[model samples]
Target: MHLWYAYMTPRTIVPVIFGLLLTVVAVEHIFTMTILHGKSMPFSTMLLSTSGNGSDLHCPSVRLSARVLPQIALASYPGSGNTWVRHLLQQMTGIATGSVYTDEDLRLHGFPGESLSNGSVVAVKTHQLYDETFYDRTILIIRNPYETFLSLFKYIKANHTGAPIIDKYITEWGSFTANEIGHYGQFYTSWMKHLDVLPIFYDALKQNLTQELHRIKVFLGQSGIKGNVRCALANADGNHLRKHSAMPLDFFYSKEKRLAINLLINQTRKMFKDRFRNVSESMGTWML
Candidate 1:
């Protein structure tokens, strides 16, 4: 605290802090946009390459495994626990899943998914829109949208290294919330329309790991690996995730604010009502 005060006072800090913070946020935003569109570009060439015909964009060469299992796409809105799924699945199969946004934790546990040339079957996890060309099968994971946004808010806060960035985050909260809600709604509606997708509900997953694991194994044609479920659960440690979702009651701050948020969630639900009504028990955790 003393060291921080030596460099500046509160009056001199906001602009400098906002500038640096905005740059990081902006670059990360660009990265997410490109990854969502391309689903597999390496960072070095993500914004660099173009198609031969000059009308399209092509990602730089990725060294891919010649002998690989069917590629499965594990996808969800950001903060819907996509990384957790990768960790568990990798533990179970002794194979790694890749992501568009590389995580050091994933690297420590398995391998960087974008450059996946490993001979084992690999799952490519992403928050990208449903891209048919990216995988042979798809897994779409959904959490309660309200909780998803709230978790995302906390996640952005967690990623900051020095002082808290809550002020800036709150300033930008309206934009962030709008984009996330709209994008996830479209993501759910679009992906669920597909005939091949295997859906996983985040809350249900936390409630019953064994059941979800069995279902995923069957979906990925790895039913033989069912025995690895316990080890995978033990290794994945889902309880840690539960703590992340524990927001204080006053987090929303006002009854009116909560009502508005609920209204937005209701509209989103109605947008996909026909598709989700029958599957509410499994997919509509947001309704509760």
Candidate 2:
């Protein structure tokens, strides 16, 4: 009876240990989700939702271009709504968008062609200012630097998830604002100098999605797009887009930081006006 009891104890203890480990892992996952996403959901449901299964959201079937396409760049600074625009582009064109950097979350979500920059996809996403000859054409998306900095800070803090900035990050905001302000100004200013570039404002895109999408479609030289612009407009806020919850400027930045950001904004507006003299005043008004 003693020999039998010893063998049974080891077997039972092994299963108990395995079960405890799994429970710990599950709890940790739930905690992370709550912190990052602002709510705790069932693990299976989270997986299904993120993977685009068992959900009501419209997930477009995106594919690589049939033929080798030109290496068109969708360029922007970090937190400039580049991913949202990519979602729109993919929906409208039915062609997959490639990114210079591989994001596993983005890859699993919808962007199957996450890291192919060889021009098989319609356009490749890039945040850096590449050489003039690298891209056949470029689409530069510019957002307000103040908002851009805040969004980027939140993104980094949440480990690149679509999470809002929590109060715990207030201490870090000052330093982050100081450092990123110059880079934000430089990214748009340098990219605007590119001859084969079409500049799009992030605010304008949100305000007039259909019109902006039509403008992009024409620029991409797609005379007949596979996906409907109307449908794309209806589903503009796809899964990839982060919810825009506007916090007061003072909440994130000091008066000094605001002044610095405003100066850069004015300089960028002047540079943009000088570069694209013929662009409509309405199109440029968003900078103000």
Candidate 3:
């Protein structure tokens, strides 16, 4: 009786212990290699790239595995035309508004909706700064930093929800261009440091949406994304794009201020022409 009980206990206990140990080791390895390795790009890069002129930053040519075709993230800061790009891409790629997913952390009500995973290729819009610790493939969209700040300022001033932090920027309006102004400064710094990901100017989206859309389609194609993704991205009509909703110029400023800001934005954007062309061409031409 004792020998029978001993044999049965040993047989059952050994396999259970072995299975548990193996599971723990596998989990530890996955955490160490994937999450802790610092191999993926951080969301911070997306936010920072929108702050200033980072045209000269050297970036590695983005490479993706042929099997995955890579996920494309439309990264930028607030008021930097992310939604506009989304509107254009959704129409171009046939990604329904119902299909586009908002950032999980920023979702208004903690509602879990459809993840970008349902589609073969995921294109997300991000407002986080780039940090090389998260994100797979980043496509940065930039607006003039001054205008970015001005728009934010106007939005906040209009909303005025009694938050104390609002004063930090308002009080230092004159010092906005200084390095001390972190909100927009970090964006400028990041853009200057990373050049590998493609950068699209807000001005370009406004000036010649058709050409820029074509350039974007080419970039995605080079990354091995095809079929529905490619066709959806390349299908935007500039005329239709011009009609998309935006932060109305009248939201915070008089007509004169809006015109002046527009003029300034155009003037500064002209300085970035060469950089835009270089980045776009490097991504190659799409069949569209």
lDDT string, candidate 3, 130-224, tens digits:
65644456678877654565555544444211222456545754444343235544554454444557778777776777678777777766765
Specify the poorest-scoring 10-residue window by lDDT in model 1.
Answer: 56-65
Q: TM-score winner between 1 and 3, please give it.
A: 1
Off by over 4 Å in 1: 1-66, 109-121, 160-165, 222-227, 238-246, 253-288
State the TM-score for model 2: 0.74
If scored against the real structure, what TM-score would every candidate get? 0.62, 0.74, 0.45
lDDT of 2 at 3: 68
List lDDT for all candidates, in order.
0.60, 0.73, 0.47
Candidate 1 residue 21 C-alpha distance from true site, Å: 53
Q: How many collisions between residues are there in candidate 1?
A: 2
> Tens-digit lDDT track for model 1 on 1-288?
468648897878888888899999987887786555422334354554333345433323223334556657788887788767876775566555676665564454334454342235457777777766656677778777767776666667664112235685568666676666567667776676555677787887888888898878787665232335544654455222424534453463345545555665676557545555544533333533
**Each model's backbone clash number:** 2, 0, 17
**Residue 109 lDDT in model 1?**
32
Across 69-172, the per-residue lDDT of candidate 2 in tens digits comes to 88889999998898888878886776889999999988877777899887678788999976687887888888888778767876887744566446646667
**Cα-based lDDT at residue 70, candidate 2:** 81
Ten-residue stretch with the least lDDT total in model 3: 279-288
Which ranges of candidate 2 are over 4 A from the true structure? Answer: 1-60, 164-168, 222-227, 281-288
